[model samples]
Target: MLGCLLAADGTAQAAVSESVFLDEMPVVLSVSRLSQPINEAPAAVTVIDRDMIRASGFRDIPDLLRLVPGFSVAYTRDNTWAVGYHGLADAFSRRFQVLVDGRSIYSPHFGAVLWSDLPVAIEDIERIEVVRGPNAAMYGSNAFLAVINIITQSAAQAAGGLVSVQYGEQGMAGLLARYGGGDADRRWRVTLSTQDRDRFEDTGPDGSGNPVELRERTHTYFLSGRTDWQIDPRNDMSLQWGVSQGDWRGGRVGEASEPARRESGAAFVHLQFHRIPTPGREWRGQIYYTRNHYDADALGTIPGWPLPVRVDDHLVQTRLNLDIQSIQRLRDGLRAVWGVEWRRETVESPQNYFNQGTLDGELARLHGNLEWRVTNAWLVQGGAMVEHHYYTGTDISPRLAVNYTPLAGQTLRANISRAYRSPTFFEQDGNLVYTDTGNNAVNVVTIPAGSLLKPERLLSREVGYVGQFKPLGLEVNAKLFYDTLYDYLGSQKLNTAQCNEPGAKKCFQSVNGSSLNLRGWETELHWRPLPHLDVSAHYARVRIDYEAIVLDVTSTIIDDDLPDSAPRNTFGLLARYGWDAGWQASAGIYQTDSITWLSDGDKTTGYTRVDARLARRFKWQGYGAELALVAQSIGNTYSEFRQENLFGPKVYASLALDW
Candidate 1:
């Protein structure tokens, strides 16, 4: 399936090169396998342009994702959040890949991303591209479900100083500022930004469900610099570097305990040479290092001495591309892209904790892709990748895509691919210790390590259509997809005797589960009746069927068939209006159905939320200023997350901002 997709993409690349310019091209959202416009892609793509971000009045990445179709976001507790696409979801680990400026941000320790820790400022984002299907052939593992890339604005375009301040109810307050500029000849720019948010209260169990007093705080700082040096008219070299830090308090177990604190930092340097020796060729290289640390000292009577865990990772990658349209047949242009990557990870524990043993592992991958144009209306693309993990062995992934354009404004796309997820240290060999009080003394229960876990694989197929009409100023897009899982790694209870030695009642370990099926569809509509008025709506439905399985002890089929942290029905709406007088008003509503909790029998209730914003801008000689107001949860709807395992309080807000 992957091989065919790669071949089709190669064909499309050949056909598209003649009509599109690399610098001026618009990228598709869902087709992360290729960097091409939506009209020429063979998959569902949703492009969230910069204008949409500004009009939505979102102050953070999570808020902005709510407007995207086929995605669901839920707060676990405190400042932690779970976001997923299609149907697959989990509290600590989600099956998706996230990138910022072509760098993977998913944590290797937990196989998930900390959405709150994303460093780029919302105001500096140029666009967000979301692909809602498997992209393993191009993006490698962790792209089993979907891919989300947050592209930031170039330094040249953001050359000014601006500041924004806002305060609202529920102890919410925020500030963001940036200053950047460089001479035309020098072609250099620098920016620095910081964001802070106060902890929000949760719903208590007082029947009336009043706000619970849980203190939480989060902050992030970022600095980036870039310079461009033109070697000649046909050759140019650019260098860029970015560094960011995020700190947050959450993951508390009880009211008497101190909240968990997590800190993460990243630094990256990239160099690129475009139009080197060839007319339409480019080469790029990057090196990055990241560190993530978590301290959970107040967890379950652990005392003031926190359990500390840290991960340090380093990666180096390079890519080279050749566009052969000018030398080859005009209709048979050939484009090829290839790259190599290397990564190393090291983990440490402060308390001599050996459960998750500290180890260093290395990985290497060789990947290449090709695009070919078969005809004016039909194009094909294909690609394949091979990777070797020192501990998990080697695996191959491939993809195929076919795109057909029946009319100038209509596109039909189909894709098939295979992807896999590598096992983490926690899954391979980790020990967990839990304690229970017996007569004022702690009774420790130890969970032994499991060394037999295997990697998970998914085969996915999808088809979609996109259309744009100028007569009604309307755009509509829809997609249908199906995915099958094999060797899905899940934790299951072993025989009672495994841990029944006079104390514990249960023993659990990692195991391979039966195959599962996931199918879903998403639809979105956008209408602009007037130049200044815009309205949009979207809906998503996902269905999952877990095959029956027998418990190891009872030998009876498990009745529950729900996937964890996944909602069945989700929808959203947005409306915004901007006046010539520099005044803007916006409002939005979002709703999501309750999700099952960790394959357990528990369930969470659904809730609806509303948000509103107002802003105005004033211009002076060589400078401009802006003020804004923002509010979230205006409806005060009562909502619970993680199947009632966590809940949020009704919040009201008003904000004053000046820039």
Candidate 2:
């Protein structure tokens, strides 16, 4: 009944006319593993194209996500950022899924994305497609909230040499170089980039400096290569490899209260093959390997402390994944996809996060789906995946969706899905150590293994509408969604007999004692009033209810604080203009309502920020050159979550040459 009312409201507001498909409408492929018109996708999705990426004036990859609806972006430290969809965020985001090309980038040790250590550079990206709802049936575990696919530009699109350099306030400097060339049948591209920046100045609510906080600094370097080969008329292959390394100083040190040091390195390789034997049928296979190494050393002496203790953390992990899938036309208006996947993950640490000297895990899955055009005006889609894991036994995820086209330019859809998030290695087998010196001798405390932990699960329902008005140069997407999450990996104090030390204090293990309910509405609009001008707007409202039964736990525990920072209202707007005479400019604004941070449960003031960019292109010796200026938080000083992580005005200028 509520879904019906929402659809009727959208129908009444839609301006119906002689609608025709535009020749240049963007097509997306993340929804069902096949290319389809954006309005005809099986789920609520937002695609940010090259034009939008260039106009956003965001140098980092995570900032680009602000353009999408129902997403939250926050800064934690100098180079650490947190991004979430529909509002469960932490220093390391664990609920969302992120992929580069076809390779999952989630770390096996902690099941989190290290945004600052990603290998791909923003300049090499072609487009980003974000799914606003769960897609576990198609993407597997850890896709419980949303999925982000970052597609890089093909070698054909980058056919020459380019150089770019930028310098800005806050001790920021960046340099990038790329070269691309190939024959008609084969192509290759290579890129190298370096970045350096300073952390936000620690300040109080009144914009005054606080002496106890330590400042941070960061430096990063990256190198990447990609190649594509057309072996024959019916076969093709592509390979990509990259490496990224960075170091930073932050956190707190001993008695004098200095900064600590941390370093990380990552490398990845991906290979893909495609075959097209006949029309209406295709097959593809992919394999990838990733490695990550991280180390942190932090220690601080409290008032009246006698000794300096070690507060260092370290981990090294690797992952290998392979998958194959086939897409075939079943009948006149029906299509099907079937696939299998095998994954292996292994990790090693200094006996800090795992009890054993080493830890390893494996997973296998089989999935299938069907897309049936029941009639000219109706479509139905269903899919399911069966996964087998070493720890949590076998589990199944499923989804069902239906679309109704009542008019030539409008589509309405209703979808329901079941998704799960498998426990990370750290959660299942963690042995973190804490030393207590109150008794004159070290009393080492360890977090016991969660041998009985279960996978987190989500049941979600959503209603969505998409409308296109080519005559008016407009497109709109809106959705209403509800979610119920259960079996979350929370903690509970164990009985004396269950603890390693029978009478120890603070001995805990993970359990399933939490449930969360969330409901929200999101809407996005795009309008092109003229050939050279465009505007986009997005808005969202969300509400949540949470309950947990964890005995004797602090309020800062995971289950108690996960939803505290979810803002009730969020909005963004963007406008861009291009002139025929080699000039372009863009401006944008975003706002988020005040919310309490989980780290300290401190409420922060709501903030509004503005960003802008201006550029001019010219030819020099038959080569293209561009000069641009970018600014963020133009005239405001605000904090996203932490008072020390305040955001102030920033300006930078860049020069680029392409041949």
Candidate 3:
């Protein structure tokens, strides 16, 4: 059936068309901070362009990442998603790094990215570059397994105005508007967006519906703007600012839940300057500031109380980052990049820190890299970064890679690297205070110490291959990786009786007596058989072994087994077709092996699912309009995390106008 659809697309060449679409190219930037073909990239990489993003039929950024091999995207709740590269599968996957337009979006409070707080709209994205391997040498700490960079369309490219509206079942409604203008030397663009959706029906781990309703509603609002100015032919400046706010509710069904409601807000500003002093010599300087605030509240009844009690938890964090870099071309076939960065952060959250009203942290880093073409068939690249943090003091990360091109269209690469994840504010000083009122009794709360936390480290090796068939318009990339992690940080609660203090407090703290061994293989293939037809396939296999070696209350060191959710196998296939008559269709199928939920010891059965989209485009009075219908989980209901997280079929329609 899939082959027939691609073959039939050749006959409808004149029935459908798109205003802007491009084939997947070999160009990428995550490897060396410069545009280089995939065959020469030092590490495995994946590029998601605008055309591919549009055809995926995914409304969220995390969902689109599912197309990449080795990436896991799980829908934990109605509005919360957990994304990871190799699968620790926690609510906050903190090992990965994320950046938007050269500005880091990962928060220092928990060392996690707040996907829902990102201000940029999906329509404003131009491309996404993902380095599918550890790259701490180039990017700093937290670049443990992968690095994602999202690039938005420039004001000049967006031009005019665009409005998009979407409606669907389950009280889903969304709107996005963008306006762009300015001359060649000066350009600006502004965007506003909103989304609202109802909660899914209450269900248990066995996929049986409960009597009560689950509070899982979500709503969001965002506003953002960007500007660019060309000071001269050798210099340019860019500025950006954005704000995002949202409210969501989540908890178990048929229970009076604590922390059931959450409100989140984020604001940021970024400024950058680029200068080309001479040929083969370029320099850049950037500064960015971000503020993240969140509040979680809930009302619950106590056993002995006649009324419900309200509890509040709040966190506020602010960060300022500055960086300067220079790219120099020493000679033909030789290039290098060197940079320095400094970051300062401030936190004000009495809930998490208790009496500590506010605190500050700082970090400084220096890095350099060199890409040398040793010979016609051999390429060598090496880099290292040295960073100093308030908690861990100083550390160094280094990486080296060699690429060999034996044939015209084939390349092989071998890489070795060392990466580290610095401790977050929460891990270093979190209190995690909570009250339990049950059976007419109130238990004492625990106070924790995070000051002894240390950074986690990983040593990894990888081998990759990139092959291209120009005649067939096909590209294939495959990689095998093995990693050994030490001093893995984990949460633990110490017994109060073991302490010698007056209150003998039972404190929760971050511990480092843990380790993990992970191995994986992934492959991605892209084929463009025709101008209007495209096909892609991805597959991955992973395994994990983890051990928690810690000191117990008896002062004895013991190694305990830990649960993991790393799937043994996963695969996906996608196809898109377009006709000249303005008709287009896309379909995809995804399958995953059984996975264990580390939290509750529940297992999620393996399942296969399908998604599809169809659209019609029309032009009236020089304005382009499109109407599209999208469907997810076209077959029977399936669970991505657990049965209670069951996601059934959903259909929505959207209309977009561009002028």
Clashing pairs in model 2?
none
Candidate 1, residue 185: how far the Cα is off, in Å: 4.9
lDDT (tens digit, per residue) of candidate 1 on 185-232: 345656666766653454343224544444456777778776665556
lDDT, each prediction: 0.60, 0.76, 0.75
TM-score of 1: 0.83
Candidate 1 stretches with Cα past 4 Å from truth are 1-26, 29-34, 206-213, 228-231, 234-247, 251-275, 299-333, 350-357, 434-449, 494-507, 554-561, 597-602, 620-622, 643-659
Task: Name the top lDDT candidate.
Answer: 2
Instruction: Report the C-alpha displacement of residue 410, candidate 1, in angstroms.
Output: 1.7
Compare candidates 1 and 3 on TM-score and give the better one.
3
lDDT of 3 by residue, 428-546 (tens): 87654433332121222334443566788999999999998989989999999999888877655566664332333554456676678889899999998999999999999988887
Q: Per-residue alpha-carbon lDDT of model 2 for 1-659, expressed as tens digits?
A: 00000011111101111132123445666776656667767789998877888888888888899999988887667356777677776556678778887788887776778788898888898778888889888877887899888878777667799999988988778999999999978988999999887746544342355443545678899999988887887777778899999888765323233337778899998877777689877677778889988787644454454765445467799988888888798789899888889999998875356347778889998888799999989999999889998778799999999999988879999999999998888778776653323322122344655455788999999999999898999999999999998876665555445565522455556566678888989999999989999999899998878865645544223457556557899999889999976999999999888766543234567789999999999998887998999998989988765665667899989889999
Please tell me which model should have the higher lDDT, number 1 or number 3. Answer: 3
TM-score of every prediction relative to native: 0.83, 0.91, 0.91
Prediction 1 global C-alpha lDDT: 0.60
RMSD of 1: 6.2
